[model samples]
Target: MDPEVDTTQGGLRIDGRRPLELRRIRLRLGVFSQADGSAYIEQGNTKILATVYGPHQPRGKSVSSMTKATKGIVNCQYSTAVFSFGAGERKKRPRGDRKSIERAQQLKHAMEAIINLELFAKSQMDVFVEVLQVDGSEFCVAVNAATLALIDAGIPIKDYAVGCSITVSDKLLGDDDSGKSTGILDANWVEECSPGVTLSIVALPKVVDETETKSSVILAHGAGQRLHLSQLESLRLRALQGCKDIRTIIDQAVKDHLQIFVVTTALDK
Candidate 1:
């Protein structure tokens, strides 16, 4: 572990955020006039733009003959600006590389899990995400931006698939009122790239009865050092809380946009 990566600076993180404190999240929907739907988001220094198109005809690689018979299809493409990498890192070509393709596929599955694919039988939904700035929690930001775009396109979904990430520092702080481990939530590029366990989660941000069987988690991915079994639950709770908080922000943005649109239309009439 790097000595400088010590995130528990008196219970504060590298970016001056306390445990469970999320980065500043700002999002806007219907950002583009031509696309069926579009959105842009900024989480700390990580910024992403997502656009959604279609419920239109499914053709080419986006759909196959068999898929057209069974249900709708989703095609996701993720890309990064050439300058989006960290400042000191060598700038690489941003062509459809293997990493981007894998990220795209992962994002597509996350969206598919929430979408009512059966409703758009024989159709296709195309989602394109572009990373304008590079930072940690890249994948989670992509998932979030895409979800808002889908909503803007008026696609029906079972639930909001919110994404959040957490990272463990070399030391733990348990002096807070909760007396729980102060795990790092919403790591920045510097903290995330250093060294430690990092976990990313995408899930439905809903409260369900403990007696019920359904779960909120859709996907959980981890990288860096292996996390201990004991700490997993704590990390899960922090990430889930972050997800729930973000969902609330997105919902408010959508409602605000709608209210503005309604007022504009009323005046035009």
Candidate 2:
């Protein structure tokens, strides 16, 4: 861990932002006319684009039957462009890698949770989340992007899904021996590669439906380290806060998007 990376000093960090603060968020909807729904979001150094298609027909018969006639199926395929890497660096190929496949699965699961699967029935909705830039917490960034895309597509969801990552640092705690210190909030790549642990959480901001079954709700939680049991609560709370913050931002963006939609529709009329 770089002792110089400590936030205590006046030293400037990435984007001149302070520790525990998220990057500036920018969101745009209807980015592409070809897709049923499309959105783009920029979180700090990470930029992502998401597209939603379908609620139409299922490509395969096997999974197609899984969707109920009243409920729609969520078919997600997450990929990153070769140039989506930082500094516009070109990637060799866009797909077929093991990591990409796993990412697609993660996104599929997240989308399945929010979208009421029973509405479209025997139909499939394809969600493609693409990472245009990766600085840190790419998974969280992609999930957020996908949420906006779903909204743009006019897909009904129980709630918006927000994801966040946390990492501990050695030097930040002023004790290299205590490499397990918990750093609440965002963790860059350097912090991720260090001796610290990382946790990624995807959650529904608030359970608005009291009659709905909460236990069945999906909460994707990943922990890399065996931290002290006592610290678990704080980590969980902080991650939830991150999720809430993301929800707030997305909620506002959704409102703005709808306003634009109303204006556009009125003009067309």
Candidate 3:
């Protein structure tokens, strides 16, 4: 822990947020005119752009052959710009690297879990995510951006898929009061690069009934450090809450976009 890194002030985090608070989220749908659907998202300093295309013919014979008549094919490509890093740092390639390939596969699976593949059987859905800035939790931000893009394309989905990252650190857990073991929600770049266990989770937080009881179905979980059995439950809870919060934000954004779109179309009519 950095001695200068102040953990909390008046029950808020060093970034002036509560322990379970997420960074400010800003998003816009239909960002690109040429793509079938596109969205841009910013979670604090991390910015990502995602585009969706197809539900059309498969690009090549290999893809066509693999396509099932009962289910749609989902293809995802995740890339980061050369200047995505901070000052004095640069990437050699934008994509095709080992990390990028793994992330792409992960994004594909996440999208597959939520989308109604049966409706687009024998067709392909292409998702491309580009990281314009890298502050932290790039994978989570990419997943969120892709979800918005899919919605913009009017793709049917069972529910919203949200992603969140958590970091478990004793330093952050200890408040001035009772010092209970806690995890930080939505860890930033500095927290992620610090010494601790970090977990990334993607889940669909569905509200089952009017009572507001929510059930979270986790689609993916990735860990950056070894976690103890005793700490797993707490970390999972925090991550789930973060996912739910993110889902609420995204749902609102989608609704707002639709409202504006409807008003614009009516005026043009």
Candidate 4:
């Protein structure tokens, strides 16, 4: 952490954002015509695209029945393009690698929690996320991307499955300092690859219902460095803020898409 990057003293930092601020966000729906639904989201230098296919026949015996049993099935495939600027200076296959498989599984689990599975039993929904650029919070960004795709597919979700990653870095000491820990809101590749602890959270867009029902947090993940239980609260709070910020941007995107959709239908009629 750079003292120059101090959030307390400095009024506002790069991008004119407060300490916990997120970058400007933009989302576009139906970017691809062939897929059932597709969306692209850009957050600073991080760019991700997601596509949905299915609510169709399941691939295997297990999947076919599992989906039909009571809820819809969400199959997620997460991959980064070999040419994506972030995967490090290398040439290699784009998907089906070990890392990609693990990412895919994580994504699937998170989505399963949000989607109303019972509605489309015996059917499958495929969500494919492709990283166009690499930044600190790829996994979280991919989750955000997948959420949009699901929405585009007209899938029913209790709430948006927003995701974000928080990094705890050392500020006072050198990069090696163990005691200097500062929690960063959203990390890009440089922040991610650095020595630190990262926590990923999948949270529902918080809502204050007059009905007096409390909101729920679905999934949380701690990776890289082990953090004390005491630190969990702060980390979770930061992650939730990030999720809320993402949800706002996605909400705008959805509205824009719907407006256009309505206009097109009106014209057709």
RMSD of 2: 4.3
Best by lDDT: 3
Residue ranges of candidate 3 with Cα displaced over 4 Å? 1-4, 174-180
Q: Which stretches of candidate 4 lie over 4 Å from their true place?
A: 1-17, 61-68, 86-88, 172-182, 209-215
Deviation in Å, model 1, residue 141 alpha carbon:
1.0
Q: What is the C-alpha lDDT of each candidate?
A: 0.82, 0.74, 0.83, 0.75
- Judging by TM-score against the true structure, name the best candidate: 3
- The candidates, ranked best first by lDDT, are 3, 1, 4, 2
| Model 3 lDDT at residue 91 | 96
Question: Which portions of model 2 show Cα errors greater than 4 Å?
Answer: 1-4, 7-15, 61-71, 87-90, 173-180, 207-217, 221-226
Better of 1 and 2 by TM-score: 1
For model 2, what is the error of residue 80's alpha carbon versus the real structure, in angstroms, after optimal superposition? Answer: 2.0
Please give, for residues 81-147, the per-residue lDDT of candidate 1 as tens digits. Answer: 8888866664475648888888888898999999998898888899999999888898899899999
Using all chains and alpha carbons, the TM-scores for the candidates as numbered come to 0.89, 0.84, 0.92, 0.85
lDDT of 1: 0.82
Q: Cα deviation of 268 in candidate 1 (Å)?
A: 1.9
